[model samples]
Target: MISVVLPARNAAATLPAALDSLAGQTLDDFEVVIVDDGSDDGGATRAVAAAFSGRDSRFRLLSRPHRGIVAALEAGIAAARGWAIARMDADDLCHPDRLLRQARHLDANPAVGLVSCQVAFGGDARAAQGYQTHIDWCNSLTSYQAIRLGIFRESPLPHPSVLFRRELIDRHGGYRAGDFPEDYELWLRWLEAGVVMDKLPQTLLTWNDPPGRLSRVDSRYHTEAFFRIKAGYLARFLARINPCHPRVIVAGAGRITRRRAERLLDHGIVIEAWLDIDPDKVGKRVAGRPVLPWDAVPGPEACFVLPYVACRGATEEILDRLQSRGFVLGQNCLPAA
Candidate 1:
């Protein structure tokens, strides 16, 4: 059986549609565990869940006080019965075959600890361009190695579209509560622990981008928090890959990128050089590191390269240059955002 964990908090506006989608799934061997995290919308959220539970025996609702998402998720996970724990949000809609496909993939590929799928973003037509770009970038990472290489660049998998083995979560101590995005932190932790993760190429979820989403309002998902998380994990990953404590070369000479790279210094990562295409910044020293031209970047035998630029097109160009120079991704070079 597959246990679907749906966390809700004042999600009355879109909870019904989400539950309805689950009810319409092609797979029948699944249970939905809805954790109502203190929704105060006149008990509307509870009413929705109650109605669904009455209609479908597989649906169950667990009401709790106003605890955060981490607590709600932990409660739901503890109550789950299936070996495979699938995640769902109160506002997202899953495709009819999402459960069947994901469960089958896990059954066939026992080595894969977690699997996510492509997502279709809904709401706000004006903001579609940015969301589309992100979706495209995420879809490009279809293999385990590709996902790991791009993990630090961004959240390579959509949280709501993922289905993972319960054992993996148990071994990692479950979701961690901190001053950073919980989903990203969990993925980073799993990667650090050598957990194999991959994403399906097909879009299996409709992700709603409402203005009041937690990511927009919560300080934990802020830009600085993401950078801090990335720097911490990147430093540890680099250290593990390079036992000799080789100097790290950061690509990009912008102030913002430099600021993010500087955070790595606090983690004991030595930033020995910076690679840039700009002639003005070349030969100059920034943050005690000399900014060198692209041709001057150290080879794989010397230092590890991290592409710190955020521009997607420019990042691809930088990656091409690194690859041409015989730098292997996830080894001597890793892309960063």
Candidate 2:
């Protein structure tokens, strides 16, 4: 059986549609754990969930105090009774085949611990171009290697699109509440612990970007928060993979890139030099380190490199240049935004 853990607070307006999709899923052997997170909508959320529970025996409702999403999700997952736990949200829609395909993949691939499906952006792409672009990039990473290599760059897995084995939680623990986005932190933590996570090629979920979505309203999901959380983990990952434990050549010399690089530096990782193709920045000193031209990049034997460029298409170009010089990713070069 597959247990769908969904948590929502004051989401009565969107609950019915989400419930309808789940009730209509092609997979019959599944349960939906609806967590009503102390809804403030005059018990509307509870009413909606209760109505669903009354109509469909597969749907179950759990009420909890408004402690936030992490607490609510943890509660729901704890109450779940399936070996496989799939995540859902109160506002997103799912394809009828989502659970069957994901469950079958897990049953067939014993080694893959976690799997997420490609997601369609449910918002207006033009209005929410950045969000849509991010989703598109995430969908491109369909293999375990691609997901692992790009893990530090951004969240490669859409949270609600994921269906993971329950043992993952038993072995690696569950969503952590901290100064960061919980899902991103969990993925990084699991990957660091050698958990293999990948994505399904099929887009089986529609990721909605509601006006009050947690990512937009919560400071814990902000840019600096993400960088802070990724830095310490990236530092450890580089230590494990790169022969030169804490020393790396950073790929960009711009202000924001320098700040991001500093996060790793804060974790004791040293920048041997900086890399930039621009002639003006070349032969210059940035934060006491020389900004070397791309051609001056040290060979894989000499140093591991981190391409911290965030500009669109720039990081990919830098990665291509590095690979052309025979630097294997996760061995000598790790690209980050």
Best by the lDDT measure: 2
TM-score of each: 0.95, 0.97
Off by over 4 Å in 2: none
lDDT of 1 by residue, 190-292 (tens): 9999999978877899988877878878999887888888888888888887633647888998998999888988889888888998888899997787999
**Candidate 1 has which clashing residue pairs, if any?**
none
Candidate 2 lDDT over residue span 251-328, tens digit each: 999889999889988888989898987788899998899999877877899999899988878888988999999999
Question: How well does candidate 2 match the true structure, expressed as C-alpha RMSD?
Answer: 1.2
Q: What is the lDDT of residue 299 in candidate 1?
A: 74
Clashes of 1: 0
The per-model lDDT (C-alpha) reads 0.88, 0.93
TM-score of 1: 0.95
Clashes of 2: 0
